[model samples]
Target: MPSMKEELDQSTTPPLCKTGCGFYVNKETRGLCSSCYKADVLKKKASSEVPKILDVNNNVGNQEPVENHDQSNKVVKKKNRCHVCNKHVGVVPFSCRCGESFCRLHRMPEKHACKFDFKAAGRVVIEKQNLLCVADKLEFRFFKWWELPDMVFQSYHGWENWLDGLRLKKEVKDYLEAKIARRKIV
Candidate 1:
């Protein structure tokens, strides 16, 4: 048998605790150190007591039925129905500025005849124009070749411009016709 001094030395050597506490564990307790075991007991006791406290507190409230109280505490979302359709409930409803909810089919203000202020809508249009202007440089070189014919025609014709506004120069029209003829012949 080891002597008392030897036993004392072994115990004092700081072996790893099973509870991952980083410090040496007490040898008297099975695997767990005294502090960890006490913590575990306290945690279990707290968990068990929580539900009992809730139940007691719930019963002590006013004279509403238990089922009603349970349901009332829970947030029950009202199903959104379309103002126009009045039948089908929407999963993803669209809300208008006019304070009316709508389905996908009648979400637009025009579709529902909503009385939204036109001044507010004009601001959105102006913002869209500003965004387009910011996205492209206003230099003459950046102008598209396709728009050149229309721009030239519109400047001279003014009120006499065609409804489609696709007037091409006489030379360009003749060239396109010749190309189409050549393709057909081949």
Candidate 2:
């Protein structure tokens, strides 16, 4: 059985690749032949890749390019050698917070002369994590029980056992108690 799209395509004269690749067009290839579409996609990917730092620096005055964080992460992942000594950091690479991977010898900031301010970064992290709550001072005025009115005492006093409740006969209490047994409100 043919799909709805295939059935519809069969009715039409069959669109060719926009690039004139002499092949039948389909939705998957985006109106292009499979090979042509793949080549196009690869070309687009290559063009979209982050420009080198040197190229970026050269073009700084002409136009400001958007910073890509994914490129930065990729650079870190690709760095298997120390930026300082150029030694290969095998297996477990010691990655510094300075956005550079280093060998065991030059892992420390002091060894590599890393310009990243550790104290400032730490301060910023602390500031973000430890939020200082700004609120009006709680005006909790302490009061003595004797100083309060009788109305306040009536509600709070003997809250569990209602002393002012209507007195029920012992037989009625037993019947209700049996029916409501083992049931808690919560």
Candidate 3:
């Protein structure tokens, strides 16, 4: 018969870790070994503590308003609450020309029945459509600097009648020239 020690050694099963660490671990432990599980638990505890610290700092600083900070933050928080639902809004929230900050759900002036001028809105739409039509007419047309005077005269009736049809007033021409100069430099 085999010796008692040899029989016992043969019957004993090797320890195995659940995390595939190739190390011996207690059979009752799940997933990670003892050391890895402890480390993981410590990491989770640290992350949770960090968020609490951040929340504390944010609350403390915001509780009392500072002069150097954005005054709009305080104003928006207090007065610019959503006009319809009275909910607080963040920075750059949509505000109607009628002087009210509206949440995404009620951002449109018509949705809130704002007293905006419908005539002004119609004028703006007409102006935009006119601009689009002008852009479409000039889309494929290209002219060099030397051809500018000829093109302008031809497009209008002639040099003398150019001022009648052409809308380039002296102030507008100066502004456009300045803008073109700035664009060239940039």
Candidate 4:
């Protein structure tokens, strides 16, 4: 029902991206610009694709989305062999600290250039495995000679009456008598 001129005008200047990318939108893309459209396409392409990482600050000035690395080594290992490499495997396939399996040629960290800090991880393990032990000093109780006489009476229960009958030395008897008098006064 539209005229030729109307169709021409619509085709001449493609609509601005609905996402506000400032780029001309493609009708086939629904309303997004080429870059935004590509990103959306990639996001829905497969589950193995590395998810788009957003900046922490999320500056309003830059609206573009950050994508993953294109390099084979830098790209994430999605499947068994990896999405980029099509799961290519060598003779020996072993997992690394980077959370990906590598081949015989790239098994060593030096070969694949692992990002995990071996030294720091080792230090943490060592610290947990070997702990430092420190204990408090032991305490001892000392009793004076004057308190020893009282201790003897307490242990013997009723030795007060037999104290003089024991025929003890005069000095000992005098000491016991003095302690007994002190006890009666209290």
lDDT of 3: 0.65
Q: Lowest-scoring 10 consecutive residues by lDDT in candidate 1?
A: 138-147
**Per-model TM values vs. the true structure:** 0.24, 0.37, 0.25, 0.30
Selected candidate, larger TM-score, 1 vs 4: 4
Please say which candidate is ahead in lDDT: 2 or 3.
2
lDDT of 1 by residue, 113-183 (tens): 99989788899889888864445333333334333444554565642343234466676556544644664
In model 2, what is the error at residue 39, expressed in angstroms? 8.2
- Candidate 3 residue lDDT tens string, 133-162: 344433234332323645554665644454
Residue-by-residue lDDT tens digits, candidate 4, 34-94: 8999898887877566566677887757777556566776865344563123456645457
Ranking by TM-score: 2, 4, 3, 1
By summed lDDT, which 10 consecutive residues of candidate 4 come out lowest? 137-146
Q: Using alpha carbons, what is the TM-score of model 3? A: 0.25
What stretches of model 1 exceed 4 Å from their correct place? 1-80, 89-100, 124-186
What TM-score does prediction 4 earn? 0.30
**Which of the two candidates, 3 or 4, achieves a greater lDDT against the reference?**
4
lDDT per model, in order? Answer: 0.66, 0.70, 0.65, 0.69
User: Considering summed lDDT, which 10 consecutive residues are worst modelled in model 3?
Assistant: 138-147
- Would you list the clashing residue pairs of candidate 2? none
Looking at model 3, the pairs that clash are none
